[model samples]
Target chain A: MIRFFTNVWNNFKEYIVLVILILASLIILSQNKSPQVQKVRAIAFGSFATFTSIISDMFSVTDLKRENQQLRERNAELMIQISKLRKYGIINEELKDLLGFKDTANVPLIPATIISRSLSMTQNMLTLNAGRKHGVLPGMPVVNDRGFIGIVHSVSEDFSIARTLNNVDLKLTVMDERSRINGIMKWTGEELVIINIPNTFDIKIGDRIVTSGISSIVPLPLPVGIVEEFRPSETSGFSYIKVKPFVDLKPIENVFIIAEVQSKQKKDLELNFYRRQSDEIR
Target chain B: MKFDKIFPFLIFFVGLLVQVTIIPLVSINGIVPDLILIMLVYYSITRGQLYGTVLGAYYGLSVDLITGSLLGSAMLSKTLAGFIAGYFSTETKRDINISTFNFSMIVFLCSMIDTLIFSFFSAFDFNTNFVTVLFEHALLPSLYTGVVSILFIFSPFRRKRLL
Candidate 1:
């Protein structure tokens, strides 16, 4: 019996690490009730993902070449549209003035290369080449030539992580560029969709969607995407709309991070008004 | 312990670099093979359960760092896989090639576990339906990982190094 106990002890030392790891997992699972713990968990996971993405980007040089060729071709097609828009500059200017617009604001776009993409099964995150050095910060909006991509969530010294609109975690205040009906855009996991718009909202397929600038994270009137499909929710009073994301993230290379753009004072004013109203009732 | 201890880490790092670099070029719809799982299986079969468990935990940590999923998520799945795979280690016949068949099964199982854990966490985070998690990302990618393992058996890594 003594020899048997000794043998078990000898073998126990070999698998001790695995036993400890399993125990740690159980502890985390049990202690994850606090929202603060969950936030830390999310941050840790995000950092880990950002690190892996950077390492992977170091090896994506060859793949980036092929992606660059595609982007260049797309860039040429966009230039034609830019030229046509330039031709109608007078009419656009008049329209902008009528709609209460700012003068031609020189919003300097800090462009960066795509460092790494999330191949993970959960969230859709993309790492950008720009970081704190380039004035990129959390909550800053990112875009491509097509439209709104996502918002930066985390920043390292040399890279920033953008949580694409494909992520279900993001909620953007958006409206149909044609109909003026506003809604919140969110990813539905299976498809990019919008919520909070009433069924009677005047939205249609192919109607261009743009940011309402209500959210401090994004500038007003930025292109979001086009409405693809719409249907009334089965169990709700609101309608659901599917949006095909304007930014084709799969072939992403260079993206522009918009900083020093959003008007935070407007957001603060709205928040204060709401708080005051609520306080008066209380 | 010298070669046994150091070899898996070496293979783990190599697998990680290759997974990031080489596998992306070969995937369809950005799904790459699970190279770390294959290495875990390979070593688990050669070494005993204890060795398998240790390497599995080490490999899982590396995978968690490299893949960017939840922190202990890969560790839990991989340690379980290593323990389970190690149970069948001493039973296999020595002369026969276990790489091909063993590699396929491990890829299938580990991919399923990895995907399921990720999707489960995603659903918790995003409030998406469970079905979407299973159908959207899990099914096809796991199949692709399995197919890649079959091809990996024929690659020079298997032939030249006799690994």
Candidate 2:
């Protein structure tokens, strides 16, 4: 017994240093982030959403009568607006031109519902009613009519957890839709703030935020939010900013889970990289 | 040990529900009371250092599982706090009645240490706004837990001999 313990201890220091070195290297290399990880994560998130949807099916506490009434009111308002737009003639012309512009048949949406919310003053997270069986996976982008919320992280058979833009851990590769200036989006725990841009960047309040496509996980040109606040950093290079997320996470009702319509070539490209990385790690 | 088998598990569920649900509703700034620390302190005062250290680890693990932060973060902090509280238990005056004031002081000290350790791990540095975190998260929750201990300390659970 003494000999066994001594032998293990003798080997422990060498193994510990090797493990630490490997971890440090991975951190440095992966900080730029490999898009393949994002895609796999999204798939895992999709699975979680599918599971949550199943569980929610078993029980619901919402007042159906009130929900039906609200839906009817919204539909009536939309109909009235549509009629008004037609009377003006410009709405038809604009919509007709838009319909002629591009094909949207390729990308399909899986519907998911919000199950729970993390509302601590300092931190926030969301659980969705969906998961694996419904094709929800980790790294899948969650959004509502307003804009992008955040990516799916973990998935269980019946439910999945997500971190929103409000979460400090959430980081998205984003750019100014107008100026095309690229930067990363992050949340600082103190407030609903997203900081870290160099002063040289051409960013302005009300400038539309969109996914930069630099990250394979995030689809390009998807609306994120509007820049709400900006201030110069004490050091010369960066400007800190706050964004008003388009979706009101406090009252998230319905969300759309997007299945990225990756071309066969792109799918192979990512899978190849992942396979290589896994092999190297092992 | 039989008490350990049952009471800790019971405390975990009750503490977690109160931690995630009830405490959040009543907090000054969404800062929930630390039920685990309160229970640990109670045990530490009566049980001893070894028991307190073990309970602290269990409490921390439960929080980590529920919150889904980095694993072991809470466990590390909780264990340290439990060990420190154990040292105090040895010196506490046996005749001094456990009063609201006494409970307040014990909880305030233990939770302050808990908050400082948690913050240190989550952030790489202790340089930013220690006063705010210590006051808001640590001090407020400690006071709230202290008030709860006043009621719990006299309950039937305490009537049974700790041994």
Candidate 3:
């Protein structure tokens, strides 16, 4: 038996090793959600991101002059828009006061730069320079001036990884700005798509999509994308709406992490409501 | 011999550095060349099959951990890719494979397997069209990696070290 085992090892050693490694990989894949794996991943990326940030900074300096000029022009344009919005803001505040509405719009923003990006067809990720030290936490919404980028996935001491809108694993609840029809939006590998919209929905091409207020991940109604294609599935009686995002991940260097997740009070209220319903059924 | 054994890992780190930092700049429609896979194919062709298989696993796992992709996706894909690339590691043809255009073709083959397995694991959805997934996630990236591998054949270091 020993001799036979030795013969197998000698003849098909490569195959044996391959099978072992593949099995190990599958096992590790299964353990992705385990706390230990997440900790190790955090440490690994945290260490590597230090070097990446230096290299990224080196590249960024060359583009600074051009970016500065663009920013200056954008600042001027924004100044004009801000003045116009100020007039609306005063009227909105007076209206809110008359209606006895509470303000919940003030959320802190943590500024960070993209240190590196792992761009793939499905698992696109960005490493940012902000982390736990900067009050950036997992599930915080990352956005730029243009619009929503993604949710922060993991955070280390000095770095955090975010799954961009292009990542397949990230699904968001978004609504059509015009029709107010809510649908689940996700990256379909080829494009950003809002899936399972009923055919009777009033969504149309050129309609703007925004994060739904009902979404737990991003409770704020933030701009997401514009509907570019509306493919109605005849048999399924549903539509797949393709979206073109306002923020392009490629050229974006700096971003702001909205330092908030779904409110604990809201979550508890929802949980209690579900518990009450379950108890009533019992 | 010790230096030779460690050389591939050094190349992998440098390749990964370039991959994360420089590769994104050249990306077309979110498709970028797999510099790490190109380096893996080169080393696997020079080394034996057993060596290649083990190296591929290490490379894949490292990438997953560092790049924050799905933990085991790259590991599985790269292990198979390395095993397949090892078929051309015969002593008689190693030099020809490395120095000629065949290297690119081999890189293409390995990259296809790598990307296909990765996409299948990370992005496969029942609603998605398989052919579209294959073309966008596997074929285009492999072609880009294969085309980029051509530069390796003509590098000054190739003539200095391999020839």
Candidate 4:
């Protein structure tokens, strides 16, 4: 027995260490969702992103000219659209004033950069430079020059993680632009899916999908994706639709955190809904 | 352990930095090469089992902290990979080299084990097909890591004995 024990210790010391370390890892995994560990991960990953961004910036300089040209073109297009929208808004306001309609609230945009991305297959998250210090909070919406990206999942003082739109874990209220039909959006592994759309809806390929804006964190009519294909779901009464996101996420560098949010009263109600939904998941 | 042994470990850490920074730019369908796994495999075959496991834990912890993964998934995956690689460890360190097919096989196997465990803990979902993840992520990444390891063997650092 003594010889057996000695031989095992000599031959399998690494496995013993592996077992002990795996146990420690399990403990950490169990607490992975806690706010305390989330904060720690935020701080540590924030610093790591900051450090790596410095290196990425060096390599990215060579592509600056091309990226700058593309941004300039996009900026011009957006500016023209903004001017058109302003004219429409002015006309609408004048009509609303005559009708005694209350003015709508508008929140400011907080611009940020995409620092890095999570390499996990199931968890599609992006690390952004904006954080609590920049008034970025969890559940804040993220967007790029193209369209809606995701919502802030967690935040540190100087950095926050955004759950990308392609992530399977995120369930959002999305609308079909043409038909104005709304559905729940989720990742279907092979593609982004808009779930539970009834077969009766007059939806089509190339129709724009945007945020239904039922939630406070998301502004209404935010562009998300375009419908790609549709198939009958297992649920029997619904159409399982695939959507191709406007933002591919690959080669994405410059993005904005649309810190635009609703009033506290409205936001609190939506937050309660989200909290309940999350609780039900667990 | 000799103080100079720490230098080679620093070289291994560069692999971690590469994994975090450069690999993402070239990721093939979100399956980035596991440079740290390859490093652990190399060191295990060159050194011994006990040394590899401890170093693997450290490297994996660094990855978990940097990537904000499910906290301990990488740590467990990497520690287990190191222990597995240690099985292929040579008795004598003098003959250790990465040129042979044997070295690549060890790296390939170790990397597959690393990815399998990592995706299992961090990415296993009821929605996505497990077979898809196993093919695109675990198997593909292991193959890519093995190819990259072979390339590194011919690099100047290894040739000059700096790694």
Candidate 5:
């Protein structure tokens, strides 16, 4: 018995370690939402965010000049837009005062760098340098200058993780800009698909799709993608439309996290409604 | 000899660094080659299954921790792959030729197993279409990882030379 035990231990030590690690990981993952674990994770990721930031800055020295040039052009365009908006603001304010309306302002964009990307094929998440310290919270919408990129999933102190539009975890209420028809946008393993769109909706190839703003956390008309092609399901009376996302996650480095978020109560209500719909379908 | 014990971890760290910075430049359809898996293959082919499996598990755990993905999925898949690759390892370094068709075949098989298991476990259990993910996601990345394994084939470092 002693000799048999020794032989098994000698032969299967690595397997033993593998099992232990896997169990430990499962425990850790399950406890990720606990406050203590979150605090520890936050501190660790904060330090890691600093380390990765330094590395990214060191490696990105070559792109500095080109980035500077692009920034300059963007700044010039912004200046022009600011001047044009100033004229409209005066007219809008005068009308609002006449109507006794509340003042509205655009939410400021929080800029962040993509620090790391998910290594798994089935998941498409990216880590950003901005985190809770930057007021980044889970469910916040992220966008590049061109269009919507993703949603913030979790936040550490100085680092946060996001599930990109390509990930199955992300689902958006989107609209055909031209047709004004609403649909749910999600990623299949292959492509971004808007399923169950009524066949009556006049969605065509090359039509723009944007956020419907029906979701509490995100705002209206955020550019999502362009329609590629759609096909009607005769039996279901719906269309499966494929979309080409505007922001290609592969090459994106810098992105802005929109600070706009609905109140907790509102968001919770919307979430419950979604859960109910899903349960009913199931 | 002690360096052999530490070298795998060092390679794993370097693999992470290269994967994020350099591999993104050449990603095909948003799928980057798994560099650490390639290292696991190299080490497993040079050493035996036992050593390779342990190293692969550690490598996978490190990746999950750093990348902030679902933990243990990579470790489980990679450990099994390492065990499989260990059988293909020769008893002696002198008997093994790293830069050969046989080496590529071994790497290909190991990557295939790693990706298949990793994708299966990581994917959403109910919602995902298994066959679509198996083909669209796992197959291409495995092929890409196999292609990238060619770089290690002709590298200066070999187990015999290092020793």
Candidate 6:
């Protein structure tokens, strides 16, 4: 029996190890959402991001001249837009006062620079220099001058990771600015697509898409993308809408984190309503 | 020999550093070469299969944790890739494999499998177009990694000399 066992071990040891590691990986995959795993992941990435930020800082210096020029141009553009918006703001405040509407413009923005990026077809992620120490938190939206970039996924002491719009795992509720129609938008590995819109919907090519106010992840509306293509399914009544994002994530360096999550009051109200409905059913 | 055993891990860290920091700058249409896979293939050819398999798991898990990819996706793909690459590690042809164009070919093959398995775990669905996924996620990245591996053949410090 010992000799037989030794022969099997010598001949198939590689296969045995491979199977063991494969099983270990699957177990880890299943534990991805556990708090302990999340803690370990946060620590691991936090330590690595410190080293990566140094390398990123060295490379960013070479692009400073070009970035400076672009920022100057963008500043001028925003100056003109802000002047125009100020006129509307005064009238809007007076109208809001008359209607007794609550102000929602007090959201804070935290500035940060992209320290590194993990570029993949389906899992594109960005590491930023802001984290818990900087008041950055998961689920906050990261934006640039162009528009929305991504949502913060994880945070540590000095760094945070963001899931970009190109990542397959992120799904968002977006609306058409012109038509006021809402749809679920996601990265399809090949493109950004708004799925399950009926063919009769009023969406058209070149319509601007923005985050919907109804979305739990991002309650405030923000520019997302523009509809690039609208194809109706041949067999089904649904249409497929492709979006071209305003922000070209590859070249972006600095971004602002909109330091907000869904309001707790709203969440609690919704939860209470659901509880009442379930109680009635019971 | 001790230095040689520890050397691949050091290369993995440097490769990972370049992957996350510098590789994005050179990305073509959001597709970049897998620098870690190329290094894994190189070391698997030099080392034995068991060593390659274990290293692949370590490298893949680290990438998943740090890069925010699905935790086990890369781990599974890279382990299989390392095992396949180790098949070419026979003593008789090991030198010939590293010194010649064959190294690039092996890298290409292993990279394709690596990317395919990784994509399967992360992105595959019934509605997806298999051909497009194969072309974009598997082929392009593997070709890029393979082309980059050609540099190893011509490095100033050649195989066995560097270690």
TM-score of each: 0.76, 0.67, 0.92, 0.82, 0.81, 0.93
RMSD of each: 5.5, 8.7, 3.3, 5.0, 5.3, 3.2
| iRMSD, per candidate, in listed order | 4.4, 8.3, 0.8, 2.0, 2.7, 0.8
Name the TM-score of candidate 1. Answer: 0.76
Instruction: Give the docking tier of candidate 5.
Output: medium
Q: Please report the candidate that would top lDDT against the real structure.
A: 3
Q: Model 3: residues >4 Å from true position, as ranges?
A: A62-100
**Cα deviation of B3 in candidate 3 (Å)?**
2.9
Using TM-score as the measure, what is the rank order of every candidate, best first? Answer: 6, 3, 4, 5, 1, 2
Model 3 lDDT, full chain set: 0.87
- Model 6 lDDT per residue over A190-274, tens place: 8899998999999999997888878989876677889999998878899989999988888887887878888899999999999
Tens-digit lDDT string for candidate 3 (B1-163) = 8998988876787788889999988888778999899888888898878888989998999899989999999999999999999999999999999899999999999999999999998789898788988888899999999999999999997677674
Tens-place lDDT digits, model 4, residues A171-196: 88987766768788887545788876
Chain A TM-score of candidate 3 vs. true chain A? 0.88
Off by over 4 Å in 2: A1-60, A65-123, A144-146, A192-196, A220-224, A247-282, B91-99, B125-163
Worst 10 residues of 1 chain A by lDDT: A79-88
Off by over 4 Å in 5: A11-45, A61-104, A268-282, B90-99, B123-131, B159-161
Select the stronger candidate by TM-score from 4 and 6.
6
Could you report the DockQ of all the candidates, in the order they appear?
0.37, 0.16, 0.87, 0.59, 0.49, 0.82
Stretches > 4 Å off in candidate 4: A1-8, A62-106, A198-202, A234-237, A261-263, A269-282, B2-13, B92-97, B160-163
Q: Candidate 4 at B85: error in angstroms?
A: 1.4
Clashing pairs in 6: none
Quick one: ranking by DockQ, best first? 3, 6, 4, 5, 1, 2
Q: What is candidate 2's lDDT per residue for A1-282, written digit by digit as tens?
A: 999878876766334433443344335334324455444444543443343444444445568734743564354334334433433353355786777834333345566676544423344566676666678777888766566777876666555666777665677788776777777776554544445577767888898777675666675356777888888787656787777766666545566666553345776898999999999999
Residue A277, model 5: lDDT of 100
Tens-place lDDT per residue, model 3, A1-282, is: 999999999999999999999999989999999999999999999999999988888876657745764664354334324433433354567786799965554557777788899857799999999999999899999877777899999999999999999999999999876677888999988789998888999998998788887898997767888999988989999987899998888898887788889999999999999999999999
